[model samples]
Structures are given as structure tokens and as C-alpha cells.
Target chain A: MTREGINQLVEEHVPKLVETITTHIETLTAPQRLKEAMLYSINAGGKRIRPLLLIATAGSYGSVTNAAYKLGAAVEMVHTYSLIHDDLPSMDDDDIRRGKLTNHKVYGEAMAILAGDALLTESFSLITDISEQDLAPRDALFLSSRLSEASGALGMVGGQVDDLAAENCSLTLDELESIHRRKTGALLAFAVEAGGLVGTSPKEDLTHLRKFAEEIGVAFQIKDDILDVEGDESAIGKPIGSDVDNKKSTYPSLLSITEAKRKLRNHIEAAENALKSLSVPAPALFSVLSYIELRDR
Target chain B: MTREGINQLVEEHVPKLVETITTHIETLTAPQRLKEAMLYSINAGGKRIRPLLLIATAGSYGSVTNAAYKLGAAVEMVHTYSLIHDDLPSMDDDDIRRGKLTNHKVYGEAMAILAGDALLTESFSLITDISEQDLAPRDALFLSSRLSEASGALGMVGGQVDDLAAENCSLTLDELESIHRRKTGALLAFAVEAGGLVGTSPKEDLTHLRKFAEEIGVAFQIKDDILDVEGDESAIGKPIGSDVDNKKSTYPSLLSITEAKRKLRNHIEAAENALKSLSVPAPALFSVLSYIELRDR
Candidate 1:
């Protein structure tokens, strides 16, 4: 798939995934407050990168339908939950996300918190309920574990912790990489690997796909740092220079733009190379990975 | 087991369960904010009814030191997460839980939200990791589904929503029961059913146990309503008539005190009768169900 093709594919998948998520979430009972909070943040648009990754990864192997759809939706649920809690007044305290009011602002902090909790818990239930034909017990368990690690203290939560701790403080390049690797990279890695696990991607190929995801994960964050410094706030739909305003260090702050761009190119190249090792054609994955560093919004 | 013996057994289990819950929560990432929020609310005291039901149910059939321990701890995690989210500014907005600061007040709303999310997600992972010896795949799945039902919208979340919607409004008795059944009864039912699911309890016996749990669950909430109205404030640890102050209707408010006591006794009898059909000597469950309405505080 070419870059334009990948974008079209992602666009097509985004609404379908959103619809599936909404339908599934509507099944949840009383916590309409929490569900509303989840729906608010989830409907706030992002690139739909995580769900796209899951679907694209599934497509890379064989097909992306039925059970694969549930898995894709589950990953997005996890991603959305993280973003909701992350934007809380006690955390990043952001007022806007994806050009919309933060969950707390719209739903109130309690509902926002409960909604995040509900989404997180509901994601596990979603993954575990894939029709028997889609995946087996052990595989479901494996995918659940991957999702857990990605979202748990060892992964995104850990990264958030490090990020918060590092606020108003300088850090070595390696430390920054370590932080993003767990926070952002871990979930991205899970997105790719969960696809592999569900699709029964070969062991060696899984390893390669994971490496590809890891590189792009860090590169994606670096690009985010660059965009935060130089991109249009109206286009990005979030405050530019907020990180700098908060005195938080970023790739652009630590490395010159030229150096950061060079590093991003290196990672993107590495991601492309990793795709070559996949047992099946992965043009879509490669295309998406390439755009991560170059997209303006 | 007599009623006194059941109380003594529960008394013995409380510290161990609290310790386990504390230890498990402490393992949450060292993000001081998140950990502080989790620890603050979790350390607060409660009845530990869910854990007790789980352990007692498990003990009724066989030894489940390892299997029941984790399930007990996991249930507490879910319960605690619900409480933390419930007390958020957007919800009940309570300052104190069990005589200490609530999670949001202590850790800020953001961290409290994230911490609750973490605990909720981690609960499933904790349950799924139960050794295969203790719970087969089918049983594990069953337990997961049960827990999900108990905690999800049809259960706790549903009740919470009704409670929120009815805040400062008069509630009919049927509406009150509907809320309490989902809010408190669902988990209690799960507590007993989960215990039986993990044990060698007959299918029929499990059904009866669920009935028993449901009765006691409603009865338990009624007792709480009564206590909130007439019990000593210091003994209850919550201000007397706060529910009335909030304009939330309770059984004591909806029914005359004498009529409310009659309702409570009726539920207690129903709970005991469910167990009467069970041939197995589930002494602990029997005593607990039998004496549910008579307990003070």
C-alpha cells in the first residue's frame, strides 16, 4: 500500500471501528456516565493509529474481519482509556484533546475517571469474548497479557510516571527513549504483536514486526515533539509548545531539529527494513510507519 | 459454623485480605501520585464482605488457600476501584471514606482516576492468572464473565447510575431495590457464585447460593439504610441522616421504621431458606445468611 492508500485504508477502518466500539459500549449498563465519558474521548478523533495497526496487522497475515474487528476495537478502547485518564486535572491537566474538551471537562472528573476505568475493564472483557473461531484460550490469554503490559505500570503507566517525574527536569537521551519506549512503544508493540498473536504470525516474523513497531513508536513521539515545537496549533488541535511551557524536555528540546529528523529517518528506515522480514507482504504497515515522522497533524 | 463462628472466621480473614489487597496495590507502578491515590482509598476500612463470601464459599467445598486468596484480593480491587470512582467530585463528592480522605482528595482527580483504571484492569489479569489446578479454563472464563456482570453496567455500575440519577429525589421502594440489587447484590451474588464456581458445589447448590446471596445483598443494603437513619454516627462512621440530607431516599425513609425492619427480616429469612435446600454443610454461608438482618453496623 502506498502512503495515500494507507491513509484511505485507515480512514475507512476508523469509522467502522468507532461504530463497533460504540455498539459494544452501549451494551454496558448503569454506568452511562462512565460510558458517556469513554464515548466522548473516543469519538474525539485521533489518527486511529492503534486500531488501524491492529487491523492492518491482521490484514498483513490473512484477513481482518469478525474476531479481528473485536481485537481492533479492544486496542482502541485501551488507547482511549489511557488518554482520558492521562488528561485528568491530576495528571497532564490538559483542557483539550483531539480538538475537543477533555473528558473531565465534559463529563466531570468522577465520570471521566469511572469511564476510563470502565473502558479499561471492558477492553479485557472484549478481548476475552472473541468468538472461539477467532482465537483460542491461550492466544486470548497472550493477547490479554500484551494489552496488560502495554497499559500497566510496566508500560504506558510506567512511561506516564517517568514523564511526570521528569517534568521540569532534564534527562539524558537514553532516559527519554526509555520513557517513550515503555509509555508509547509498549502499546504500539502490543498493537502489532496482538495482531500477530491473533493471526498466528510466525515467531520470527513477530519479532521483526515488534522491532518495527518499537522504532516507529519512538519516532512517532519524536515527531510529536517536533510538531509541538513547530506545527500549527489550529491544525494539530492541541496547544503547541505546551510541553515547553510546562518545562518538560522533549526530543526537539534535547536534540536539534536536524538531529531529531535524522534520528526519525533512521527509525523509519529501520521500520521499513523490519517489514522485509515479514512472512507476508506488509506494504500498509510500512506505509503507515513512514508517515509517522512526516505528518504535520 | 454458628453465627458467632462465622463472624470470627470473617474477623480472621479481614486482616489477611486487607494485607493482600494492600500488597497487590503497592505493586502498582511507583508513580507516587497513582500509588498514593490507590493506597489512600484501599487502606480505608470496609466490611470485606465480598472476600469473605469468596473464601467461605471456597472453603465450603474444599481448601482454596491459594485460589481463593487471589480472587478475594481481586474482588477487593474491583470494589475499591468502584468506591474511589464513586466518591469523585462528579459523583458522591464525599470527603471521607471510612474516616480517611478519599482517593481523589488525596491523590488529585487525575491520578485517582488512573489508579482506579489500573486496579480495575489488573483485577482481570489477576483472576486469569489463577493456577489451572485451581480453576480450569472454562471455570476461569465463567468467573471472568461473572465478575464482569457483577461489576459492569448490569450490576454495580447500573446501581450507581440510578443512585446518581435519584440523588436529591424521592425514590420508590422498587426503584430502591433495583439500585441496591445491582449496586450491592450483584457483587455479593458473584462473591458466593464465584466461590461455588471455584469449588465442587453442585449446580443446584450454586443456584441456591446465588439466591441466598441476592437476598442478603438486598437485606444488607437495607440495614445500611436503617443504620444511616438511626444508628449512632460514630458507630456508623458516617454522619447520621446524610442520605436524607442529600435527599436520597432510603428504605427507612420510604418505609416506616417498623415496616423497614419487617422487610429486612423477610430478606434474612429468604436468604436462610435458599441455603436450607442445599444438602451440603455450608456452615459459614448458612450462618452468615441466617444472621444478616440482625447484625448491628
Candidate 2:
């Protein structure tokens, strides 16, 4: 599949996933105002990169089951919750996100906090919904457990802690890499592994999936850093150099853009090799890898 | 078991549950600052009312097991996370809890938010740890699902939203009741039901437990309302007139203190009747109900 093909696939899956997310979230008896706050953020456009990654891998296993949408929604909720919390005045203090007012700016900090929390709690319930012919309750439990691990202190939260601690401080390249791997890489790993877990991928195939996830995860982070340095702010829906405002270290800061791009290419190549090692033909996964490499924003 | 016996039970279990929570949270690679923030809140004493309810229910059924501590800890984590978030400036805006500086006040807002997230996420993982015992992974999933339900927008968050929305606005008694039922009652219900769930209590006993939880939950809220109006500020670890400062409606505010006491007694009687119906003798649960009625803070 071509890179454009993957982009198209992502476009298709994103709306579907959003629809599912909206529907599931609406089922909760939250107050009208809180629901409105949550929906405002949920409708805000993200590339749905995490869900897209899960779907691509699931498709490769011929396992595009309904449960995948539920899982996809769960991951998306987790991602959305992090974004909401990160945008708080006490965190990034960003007033705008996704080309619009940030959650805290529009909803107020208290509501924004609650909205983020709602999304996180809702994510767990959504994962438990992954029960049917294709998935058992135990399978749902495993998925939920893995999601928890990825998002918790050992994964995304831990990484964020490290990232915050590194602010305005010079960090060794290895430390920077460790932070990226934990903060962003953990979720990416979960996204890739989720597909296989739901599809019941063989152990070997799961290993390949993990390899693919690790390489692309680092590449994705590097690209994000590169974009922060040079991408169009409007297209990115955030300021290009807000990383500078945070005084946080980034890939481009640690290594020149040229050097970061070189490292990015290295990880992309590793991803390609991992994709090739998959027992099943995974053109969709390959397309996703290419998209990560070539995406400008 | 008498009231003293129940007190002994709480004393014995609270530390063990806190120990379990500490051990599991330590396993996360979260930054030291974030971990400190979380531990600070988790260590704050809130009477550990929720976990005690669960242990009491389990004990009465002769169903006490190693897994009870894990479940108790998970409930405690959930309770702690809510307390942390609720105390945030955006939420209840309390600066102190348990007569100590609140999490955000001490750790700053970002760390407090992340700490809450970590505690909540780690909770699901702790439940999954129940897998190696007599319980199945499915049971863990069920417990997690229920906890999410209790804590999510539909439960605690939803109630909070309503509570916040009601602030500085006139509220009917029914509206006030709904808010309490969702905010505090949902978690209390979850705690009571959890004991029966992990112990696999008989269906009739589970029904009775739900009934008991419902009555006592309302009674607990009423008691809290009474304390808010009349509680010793230092003993309560918060300002006595906070609800008044927020211009919020309360049971004592709507019903006179005497009327509120009447309502409280009605619920306590209902809880006693429910406990009487249970297949197992639940002296500890009865003691808890009585304590709720008699306590000043």
C-alpha cells in the first residue's frame, strides 16, 4: 500500500472511531454541561494515530473485528485524556490546542480536569465492552491491564514526569530517548500489541509487532520534534516552538535537525524490517510506517 | 463482633491495605516527585471507610481471602485518587486534607494531576493481580469495570459536576439527593458490592448488600452534611463553612438539623434491616452504620 493509501485508511478509521467514542460516551449519565465539555474535546480533530495503528495491525491479522473499534476508542480516550491534562495551566499552560481554545481555557480548569478524568475512567469501561464471540472477558481484562500499564506511572505518566523533570535542564541523549520511549513509545507499543492481542496473533507475530512498534514509536517522536522545530503551526494546530516555551529538551534540541532526521530514518528502516518479518502480509502496517516517515505535520 | 471489634478490624486492615497500595505503586517507574505526590495523598487518612465496608462484608461471609486486601487496596486507591482530584484548585479548591497540605498545594498542580492519574491507573493493574488466586481474570475485569462505573462521569464525576453546577444556585431536596447519590453514594455502593463480588456471595446476599449499601450511602452523605454545618473545623480537617462558602445546598441546609437527623435515622434503620436480611451475620457492617449515625466528624 502507498503512503497515501495509509493516510486514506487513517482518515476512514478516524471518523468511525470517533463516532464509536461519541456514542459510547453518551451512554453515561453525566451532566449536560460535563458531556458538552467532553464532546467538545472528543470532536476536536486528531489524526487518530493510535487507533489507526491498532486497526492497521489488526487488519494484517485478518482480525478487523468489531472489538477493535472498541479498543480503538479506548486508546483514543486515553490519548485525549492526556492531552486535556497536559494542556492545563499547571502543565503546559497552553491556551490553545487543535486550532482552537484548549479544554481548560474553554471549560475552566476544574471542568477540564473532570472531563479528562471522565475520559480516562470511560476508557476502561469501553475496553471491558470488548466482549463477544471474538473476545472473552479475560481477553478484555488483559487488554485493560495492558492499557493501564501503558498509561500509568511506568509508562506515559512516568515519562511525563521525567519530561517535566528535564525541563530547562540539559539531558543526555540516552535520557531523552528513555523519556520519549516511556512517554510516547509505551502507548505506541500498546497500540500495536493491542491489535495482535485482540486478533490472537501468534507469539512470534506479536514479537514482530512489538519490534515494529518500538522503531516507529521513536521515529514518531523524532518527527514530532522535527515538526516542532520547522512545521507549519496552522497545520500542526499548535505553535511550532512551544517546546521552547516549556524549556524542555527535544530530539532536535539534543541533536540537530539533520542528525535527528538521520536517527528517524534509522528507526523507520528498523520498522520496515520488523514489518517484513511479520508472518502475515501487512501492507497496511507498512503504509502506516511510511506515513510516519513522510508526514510533514 | 462489637463496635470495638469493628474498630479493631479497621485498624488491622487499613495499614495492610495501605502497604499493598504502596508496594504496587512503587512498582511503577513514575518519577520520584510524582510518586511522592501520590503517596502524600494516599497516606492521608480518610477513615478508609470504603475499604472497611468491603472487608466487613467479606468477613461476615467467611470469605476473607488474600485477594480481599488487593481489592481493598484498589478501592483505597480509587478513593485516594478522587480525594486528590476533588481537592485540586479546579475542583473543591481545598488547600488542606487530613490536616495536611493538599496534593496540589504541596506538589504543584501538574504533579498532583499526574499523581491522581497514576493512582487511578495503578488501581486497575492491582485488580488484575488477583488473577493467580482462586478468582479468574474475568473476575478482575468485572471488579475493574464496576470501579470505573463508580468513578466515571456517571458516578463520582457526574455527581461532582452536579454538585458544582448546583453551587451558588438554589436546589431542591430531590436534586440535592441525586447529587449525593451519584457523587458519594456510587463509590460507597461499589465498595459494598465489591465485597460480595470478590467473595462470590450468594445472589440473595448480594441483593441484601446492595440494599444495605444504598441505605448507608445516603445515611453517610447526610452525616457528612450534618458535620459540614456543625463539624469541628480542625477535627474535620477542613473549614466548617466550606459548603456555605461555596453557597451549595446540603441536607442540613434544606432540612433543618432535626429533620436531617430524622432522614439520617431513617436510612440507618433501612441499613439495619438490609443487614438483618443478609444470610451472614454482619456485626461489623452494623457497627459501621451505627458509627455513621453517632459520629460528629
Candidate 3:
């Protein structure tokens, strides 16, 4: 896939992803403050990367138009729910997210929290609904388990727990990697692997797809840490120096920029390596994976 | 089934529910605080009505043990999660639950919120695990759908939204009924219905069991309201009039005690009617439904 092809995929799917999510959010019980809060954080977009990954990965092998769209939408719902809960007054307590007042800040804390809970449950419901189509039952179940495992305690929540515990304390690189692996990496892996899990992708191809996603996942987090230190607030849409302020350990904090860049290179290679054995022509997925490691924002 | 039978059923399942929840809680990632808050709320002794409903309903028609236990434990997790979130600083802002400090009060607002999110996700994960079991794929899918619908916006969350919106206002009896139906009725209905969904119960049996649960669910809420005004706090674990202090609407608030009692009787009768035509003996379920309508604490 050419650079233009990747851009086109993003442009097309980003809008559709937003539309799907918007419709799903509308289906939720309304006039409640928390539901609104959840929508606020979600609609206040951040590139819709996870959904894009699902679509892009699926597109690499087949016409993932149907499964990709729903899976993409489902992942964003989960992501948005996590952010709302994480930003609650009792959690990370962020007053602003994406250049605006956080969900709890605007909608009040209770709704923000419940909105998160509702979104999480809605994710499973949405995925299961996809199976109502021609997709096989095993595909739906596999996809559901992959997403759940990635988002549940063994993955993202596990990472969040570690992240919280490690606050104000120094950590070895391995500890930080372990946290990032579960927190940031697991979902990305799911985003790609889920595409394979749902699609008719062969076992070998699916294995490679997972490897590609795993490497890029780590590199993406490293880039995020780097961007936080130097990126513009207007461009990033969040206050700079939050990691520093929180005394949180991060890639940039633990490694020199040169070393971080080297590590990013290694992960990018690992990501690209997963594509080596693929039977499907996946220029778009390849471009996205490469950009994930090197992109500035 | 007699009084001894109900007690025996509770004894058989409650210990297992407690053990399963505790074991899962112990496996939580770093930040012991979050896990502690979750465990505190989950293990706090209630009558274990929801799980018992699942088990008893499953057992009524045929033998139920393995899958029944899983569904029973899963519903309690969902119920526990709701309680944790309901007590958050932004929600009810309660300081106590089940005669102990609420999740938020013990672990701070943020951890309590995450704990709830975790439990909700875990519930779905628990259901999904059934896909690997002996049940047919479609049956597993049906079980997942039932669980989500009962707890999602159209059900438990919907009721919660109404409850939040009705605060500080004088709600009509009908309006209050709508709130309780979703907030309280949906899960209770699902609790019994999911048992049938996961078990060998036939379609007609499932329908009758759900009808029975729906009536008892509303009656359960009415009894709760009455107990709040008149029952012993020592047994109830919270102070009498907490509802009044919160300015919450209830059956007794909208109707005189005599009228409320009459409505409770009507619901209990409806519940019995739903079960009277069942092919299988469900004496324990009947007794429990009767107790729900009459219990003071």
C-alpha cells in the first residue's frame, strides 16, 4: 500500500468509526450526566487509532468492511470507557482531556463513572451483535475473548494497577516495560490479532500480525512519552509535563533520547518482521505499523 | 423444596461464590488498594439473593452445579460492581455498604470506581469463558446476550439513570416503578433467567422463570423501601431513614403503608402465578419469591 492508500483508509474509516460509535452512544440511556460525560471524552477524539488498527489489519487480508467497522467501533468504546474511568476525580483526577474539561469535570463524577461502566458492558454487547451476521460463532467468541483478555485485569487494567502502584517510586526498565506491555501493548496486539481472529486469516499469518502489533505497541508508547516532554499543548491537546508532574516513570524518564530512539527502531523492525511471511498484500497495514513507531504525534 | 432446602441451597453456593470472588480479587495486578476495595464490597455478606436465584432457577428443572455456579458467581460480580460504583463520591456518596465501609470510602473514590469497572468487565469475561464449556455455541451466545441486556442501559443502567434523575424530586408511583423496574428489576429478572439460559431448562420453563422473577424483583424493592422505614438497622446494617435523608423516592413514599402492602401482595401473587404452570417443581424458588415480598430486613 502506498502512503496515499494508507491516508485514504484512515480518512474513510475514521468518519465511519465515529458514526458507528455515535449511534451506539445514542442507544445508551440518555439525559443522564454520566452518559454525556462518556460521550464527551470519546467524541473529543484522539485519532481513533485502535479502531483504525482493527480495520487496517482486517483490510490487509480481505473485505473486512463489515467486521472491521464493528470491531473498530467496539474497541473505541472500550478505550473511551477506560479514559472516562481513569480521569474520574477518584482516579487520575485530570481536570482536562483533549483540550477540554474531562468527563467528570463537566458531567459530574457519578455520571462519568457510570458512563464508563456502561461503555464497557456495551462493548461486549456490540461485539456479540456482530455475530448476528454471517460471521461464525467461533469467530465472535474468539474476538470477544481476545478483546476481554486484552482489556481485563490480565492486560490493561493490570497495567493501570501497576502504573498506579509505581507512582512516586523508581522502577527498573523491565518493570516499566512490563507495565507498558500490558497497559498499552496488549490492546494494540488485540486490535491487530482480533482482525485475524474474526477474518479467515491463516494461523501463520495471524501469528505474524500479532508480532507486528506487539512491537509497534511498545514503540507507540515510547513515542508518546517523548512527545509529552516536547510536544505543543495545542497540538497534543493535553498539558505538557504531566508524567513529570505525577512523578510517574516512563520511557523518556528512564532512557536517554538516543537510547529510546534505538529501542523504537528495534520495535519497528519487529513489527515489520511480522509482515515478512504474510500471503496477503498489506501495504496499508505495513505503512501504519511503520508510522506508529516514527510518527511525531 | 422447603425452608431447609432454601437454606441448604444458599449454604451450597454462597461459600463458593465468596471463594471464587476472593480468589479472582487476589489475582489483581499492582495497586492492592483497588483490589482491596473490590473484595471489600464483593465479600460483604448480603443474602446472596442474585446468585441463589441463578442457582435455584437452574436447579429447579434439572441438576445444576458447574455452569450454574459460574453464572451464579458472575451475576454477583455484576451486582457487586454496581454497588461499588453506586457508593462512589459522585454517585450516592454513601460511606457504608453491607454494614462496612463502601469501596470508595475505604479505597478512595478513584480506586473504587476502577474496581467497579473491573468487576463489570470480569463478569462478561466470566460469561465468555462458558464458550469453552460443554454448552453448544448458540447457547453460550444466548447466555451472553441475556447477561448484557439485563445489565445494560435498557435494564440496570437505565433504572440507575432514572433514579439519579429523580433525586430531590417527588416522583409519582408510576415514575418510581419505572426506575425500580430497571435498576432493581432487570438484574433480578436476569439473575433467574440467566440460570435457565445456561442450564438445561426448556424455552417455556425459561419464560415462566423470568415472569416469576420479574414480579418478585419489584416486590423486593418495595420490601426494601418498607424496611428502610420500619425494619431493624442492626439487621439491615444501615441506619433507618437513609433513604429519607437522601430524599429518595420509594413505594411507601408514593403510597400509604396499607396501599404499599396491597401492591406487594399483588406482585407476590403474580410471581406465584408465573410459576404455577411450570412443569418442574420449584418450591425453593417459590418460597424465596414469597420471602422477597414479605422480608423486613
Candidate 4:
């Protein structure tokens, strides 16, 4: 498929994915304030790259099913919750995200915390809901298990802890990569593997998909670092140089911007090579890889 | 079973439950500080009431399986996570919990929040681990779904939002009950219902168990209110009259202490009556009810 074809596919499916997520949050019987806070973050104009990637990969295997949408929304919810908490006063202390006021800036800190907590809790509930329908119980179980592993202590949260600890201190490239692998890469990799699971791809194929995701995951972060140094602040939707202001290590800080860009390109190539091992053509997946490589935000 | 027998049962099982929970936390490959913060709260003395209730109820139906212990630990983790977040400076800002420094006090606010997040995320992973063993995947899914409902926006977090909003305001008895039912009662109810699920109890029995749990859950909160009004700070493991200090509504604030105690007894009786509808006698469950009524802390 051409880039326009993939763009059209994303355009068609992204709205549906948003609807799925909004409907889930809208139908919640939670308190109005809590629900509003949750919806605010959910509708905060994210790129929806994670969920769309999951759906695109799943479509490569078979027809996109409700389970794909549900799981996609679930992963997005986790991503959004992490963003919410990451922006908290105690964490990143960011005032803006996705070009809007952060959750705590609108909702009080307590409500924002609860909103993040509720989103995280409800993401699993959303996954389990899939088991009642198109997905098998074991598959749902597998998804939830892997998701928790990817997002939990040994994964995203653990990486955040290390990142915080490493602030104002130099980190070896190996240490930085270790942090990013768990911090950001795990969830992205899970999205790819989830699509593979939905596709009932062979174990060998799942391994390759994981490798593909890991490379892009690192590339995604490298691009962010590069953007932090030189990309347009308005385009990125947050202030540039915040990483340097915070005195944190980044790809461009550890290596020059040129080297970082080169590293990013290498990762993209590695990801493409991993896709070559797949049993079937993955044009949609390839397009997603390009989108990740090119996205300004 | 006699009271001694019940005490012995709790004695035998509480240590095992603690071990189960600690083992899960210890096994994490997370960063050291994150794991330390998590283990600090997990090691802090808790009554193990929720998990014990789950185990005892499961025992009443049949031999408690590994699934029971796993689910019990999972619920405890959720309960512990809530406590960790609740004590945050952005939330209740309490410096002490369970006779020790609150997690944030020891680990800093960011680490505390991450610890809570890790625990909550790991709880579902722990549940999924059960699916690999003695519990059916469908059953594991059911427990996880119910757990999220009990703890998420519509339940614990929602109730917490209301509870925070209601602070310094006079709440009607009905409003107080509504808040406590979701805040404290929902998870307690889930513990009992989880027991039934683990026992593979019939649907009717599950309903009865839920009713029983709901009643006692309210009673548990009432006891907490009463204790807040007129209990030992050391025994309760926190400052006394904190609800009054915070101007928060409580059973004793809404009604006289005499009346609140009377209400507590009524709920306990209702809980006992619900248990009577079970197909088999639940001596262990009955003992738990008695423990709830008589406990000083």
C-alpha cells in the first residue's frame, strides 16, 4: 500500500478507535468529576499511534475485529494514564501535554491522581470485556498479563524510577537504553505482540514482531530526543529543551544530534529487517514504521 | 469452629498470605528504589482482612486453591496501592500510616506514586498468573473484571473522589453510606465474591455471598468510624479523631455513636442472614463476621 492508502486507512480507523474509547469512558457510572477528568485526558488529541499500530498489525493478520479495537483502546488508556501521572507535580511537573492543560492543571491534583488510577484499573476491565465476545479467555488473559508486565514495576514504572534517579547525573548509553527499553519500549512492543496474538500468528512470528517493535520503540525515543534539541516546539506540542533544562541525558546529549539521527535511521532499518521474517507481507505495518519515523509530534 | 480455631486459622494463613504478597514483590526485576518502596508498604503491618476474608470464604466452600492465595494477594496489593496513593501529599497528605511513615514520607512523592502504580498494575498480572495454573482463564477474567469494577472509577476511586469532595461539608446519612459503600465496601465485597468465584460456587450462592459481603463491608466502615471517635490511637495505628479533624463525615458524625454502633450491629446481622442462604454452613465465614464485630482496631 502507498502512504496515502495507509493514511486513508488510519483516517478511517482512528475516528472509530476514538469513538470506542470515548464511549467506554462516557458509559462509565463513575462520578461526573472523575469521568470528566478521565475523558479530558482521553480526548486530549493524542496521535493514537499505539492503538492504530495495534489495529494495523492485526489487520495484516486478519480482518480487524472488535477485540482489536477493545485491546487497542485498552493500550491507549494505559498510555494516557501514564502521561497523566507523568505530568503530575511530583513527577515531570509539566503544565501542558498534547497542546492542552495537563490533567492536574484542570482537575485538582487529587482528582488527577484518581483519574490516572481509575484509567489504569479500567484498562484491564476493558480487556476482560473482550473475552465475553470475540476473543478467547486465554487470549484476553495473555494480553492483560503481558500488558501489566510491560506497564508495571519491571517495565514502565521501573524505568520512570530509574529516569528520575538519573536526573542531573550522566548515564552510560547502556544505562539509558536499558531505561528506555522498559520505560517506553515495553508498551509499544506489547501493542505489536497483541496484534500478533489477535492474528494467531505463530510463536516465531510473534518473536519477530517483538523485535520489530523494540527497534522502532527505541527509534521513537531517539526521534523525540532529536526533536527536543532542534524540532519546532509548537509542532511537538510541548516546550523544546525541557530535557536539557531538567539536566537529563538524552540521545543528542549523549551523542551528537547527527549521531542520534543516524542511530534512529539504523533502528528503522533493523525494524524493517525484522518485518522481512514475517510469514506474510506487512505493508500496513511498514507504513506505520514510516509514520513513526516522520511524525513531528 | 471455635474462636480459638478461627484465630488459629487466621494465624496459620496470615503469614502465608504475607509471604505470598512479599514473594510477588520481591520477584520483580524493577529498579531497587521502586521495589524498596513497594516492599516497605507491603511489609508494613496490615490486618490482612481482605485476603483472609477471601481465603476463609473460599475455605468454607472447599479447600482453598493456589488461585485463592493469588487472588487474595492481588486484592491486598490493590488495597495497599490505594493506601499508598491516599497518603500522598496531593491527596490526604498523611505523614503516618499503620504506625509507620507513609510511603511518600519514606520514598518521596514520585517514588510513592510509582510504587502504587506498580502495585496496581502488578495485581492484574498476578491474577493472570493464576490462569496458568489452577484457575480457568474465564474465571480469572471474571475476577479481574470484577476487581477493576470494584476498585475503578465506578467503585473505590469514584467513592474516594466523593469522599474528598464531601470533606468539610455536612453529608446526609444516605450520602455518607453511598460514599463508604463504594470507597471501603466495594473492595471488601469483592473479596467475598472473589472467594465464591474461586470456590466455583453456584450463581445463586455467589449472589448470596455478595449480599453478605456488601452488608459486612458497610459494617466494617461503621466500625472504623466508631473507632475513629473512641478508640486507641496506638491500636488503630494512627491519630484518633482524624475524621473530625478533617471535618469529614462519618457514621458517628452522621448519627450518635450509640446509633452508629446500632447500625453496625444491624449490618452485621444482615450479613449473617445472607450467609444463612448458602447451601453449606460457613463456620469460617461466620467467624470472620464475628471478628469484624469484635475487633478493637
After superposition, the stretches of candidate 3 with alpha carbons farther than 4 Å from their true spots are: A1-5, A28-35, B1-5, B24-34, B131-133
lDDT of 1 by residue, B163-213 (tens): 888988888889889999988888888888888877778877867887888
Better of 1 and 4 by lDDT: 4
True contacts kept of 4: 0.98
Q: In terms of lDDT, which candidate is strongest? A: 4
User: When only chain A is evaluated, what TM-score does every model earn?
Assistant: 0.96, 0.97, 0.94, 0.97
- Expressed as tens digits, the lDDT of each residue in B1-297 for candidate 3 is 356666777777778878877776687554566677667878788778898888878878777766777777778998988887777666787887667888766676656666777788777767667635656666666677677777877778767877887889999888888888888888888888777766677877767787788788888988999898888888888788988898988888889777888988998889888888788878778767756765556
Clashes of 2: 0
lDDT of 2 by residue, A1-297 (tens): 677887778776877788899998777777988888888898888778899899888888775888888898999899999999988988878888879999988889999999999999999998877665768877788788899999999899998888877889989889998998888999989999898887777888877888899998899999999988999998888888988777878888888889999999999999999988888888888888888888877
User: How much is A255 displaced in model 3, in angstroms?
Assistant: 0.8
For candidate 3 chain A, the 10 contiguous residues with the lowest summed lDDT are A29-38
Residue A154, candidate 3: Cα error in Å is 1.0
- Complex DockQ per candidate: 0.45, 0.83, 0.60, 0.93
DockQ of candidate 2 compared with the true complex: 0.83
lDDT of 4: 0.89
Which residue pairs clash within candidate 3? A1-A283, A34-A111, A90-B110, A91-B110
**Where does candidate 4 chain B have its weakest 10-residue lDDT segment?**
B1-10
Worst 10 residues of 2 chain B by lDDT: B1-10
Better of 1 and 2 by lDDT: 2
